[model samples]
Target chain A: DAGITQSPRYKITETGRQVTLMCHQTWSHSYMFWYRQDLGHGLRLIYYSAAADITDKGEVPDGYVVSRSKTENFPLTLESATRSQTSVYFCASSESFHSYNEQFFGPGTRLTVL
Target chain B: AQTVTQSQPEMSVQEAETVTLSCTYDTSESDYYLFWYKQPPSRQMILVIRQEAYKQQNATENRFSVNFQKAAKSFSLKISDSQLGDAAMYFCAYRRRVNTNAGKSTFGDGTTLTVKP
Candidate 1:
């Protein structure tokens, strides 16, 4: 109940379609992040938030939009999904803005774009 | 931009033997942090160890220990007396110590370690 949770654990979508992945955390962490894992490339950050209403781009933030309307929620929206966007998405949270602190990760959402 | 690299993509070790996973990172900032995370077949992310760039001492967590050479920008994970349960994908991550709005850790490609009986 206290850990991070991601909705729609498995999803299949069509190209050009809009899809949103939801992430929720009960820990009240100050920072939240979204990452995508690809074969050979590993997990790459898509977007992250320092706090509610504060978000920044990561290494691969293109084609993705994220909003943190509240501290407990950070949702990712793919305005126009592409086949290349097919990957496992993960959500993580940390107690503070410091990088050294341990981060709690959600179970991840596997999205397939056909 | 900070880049983390895990040189070995896969490795195998006999049960009860020791194994080491190598990791290297490039960062312009002098202050930063390093970490190792383990993901088993279940895909659950688990923390193994962490090291601060400013700390001279290496970080150890039970059977797991990290050889953090800040000057060389190398952070390797050593698993002593490894068990079959240790088989998993291990990742090396890096982040700046200066602090920022992004609470993300730059991750390496990852190494899949196999513990053979």
Candidate 2:
């Protein structure tokens, strides 16, 4: 309740369906990020927000969408789920964009697209 | 673009022993940061250690330490007095120091480390 949290710890959905994964943080950190972990690819960043209403794409951003309407919340949406989207999604928050600051991660959400 | 590589796919160390995991990166930027993250069975990503490219001395934390080689672009993690709890997937990551690209990190494929009791 005090740190970053991810909703729907596990999910399974059919391809072409719309799915949304929620991430919330209580620390009020200015920077929030979304990353997907895949075998042999490690954790690839999908999207990141420097502040509310400010988001940018990362290494792998295709088929994924993210929004930061509020500082404490950053949700990732799959416009049309594909089997290739099956992976563990992680949310991270940091106080600033400084390299010295460490990112705090949430309990990842494992989503399976069938 | 920067890339991080963890050469070892798997590694094992007897309890109370020491082990090192290797990592390499390709980058042209002069200022950046390196980090090692641990992900246990629970799937939580925990920061183990971090090193700054400008610093010549390696960073150490309790039983965990990093051998940072700026010229070679190598950052390796060493675990001493290993325990069962140390078993996890370790990731090496690199991040640019520039504010515009600071939050995005490039992570290696990760090495799964097993501790034998």
Candidate 3:
């Protein structure tokens, strides 16, 4: 009954439009992350939050914004969605930022920007 | 920055057969962690198995096992008695040790595994 969830499993928007992918975890984990899955390239981190109000950029963060107002939620927003940004977005959470701890992933959101 | 590499883009094995997926990484850090994550067609990232750099014994989970060669910097996943459910995209990942900045995961391109019935 308790696990990470992502909303709007599928989304479609026009170029230059704004879109947000939501991620929520019930475990109240201290660390949350957003990653985009591109073909041929595994998963690239977009952003990660260590705790509420504490966030940092990951490998690919140029076109994204993240805010952790609450410990359970870390949402990613694409200010101006481009076709290049049209990819499946995955949300993950971990107890600690340390590597030993495994990350739990959400179902993922498939975004399409026309 | 550390990098993960999965040279095999695709591989296949018959049911009940054994297969190995290759992964190599480059990292200057001595203490770290290595992981094998499986993504089925459902797209959920499942933790297959994990190995700590400090451990000499390899990690195993039922039908899954890993051959980790630290000096050669190679980690490969060996699945015995493969099943149809084993069909998925397998990714090799690395994470730096604690007390290090940028506590994030670096993943390889991924190897697509197909199970032949």
lDDT of 1 by residue, A1-114 (tens): 788999999999999999999999999998999999986656888999988999999889999999999999999999999999999999999998766788889999999999
2 against 3, candidate with superior TM-score: 2
What would the DockQ be for model 1?
0.67
Best DockQ among the predictions, by candidate number: 2
> Which number leads on lDDT?
2
- Rank all candidate structures by their lDDT, best first, as comma-separated numbers: 2, 3, 1
Judged by DockQ relative to the true structure, which candidate is superior, 1 or 2?
Answer: 2
Cα-based TM-score, every candidate: 0.96, 0.98, 0.97
In model 3, where do residues sit more than 4 Å from their true spots? B100-103
TM-score of 2: 0.98
Model 2 C-alpha RMSD to native:
0.8
Q: Residue A96 CA error for candidate 3 (Å)?
A: 2.0
lDDT of 3 by residue, A1-114 (tens): 599999989999999999989999999999898999987779999898889999998999998999999999998999999999989999999987676888999999999899
Model 2, span A1-114: residue lDDT tens: 799999999999999999999999999999999999986558999999999999999989999999988999999999999999999999999999897799999999999999
Error of 3 at B46 (Å): 0.3
For model 2, the docking class works out as high
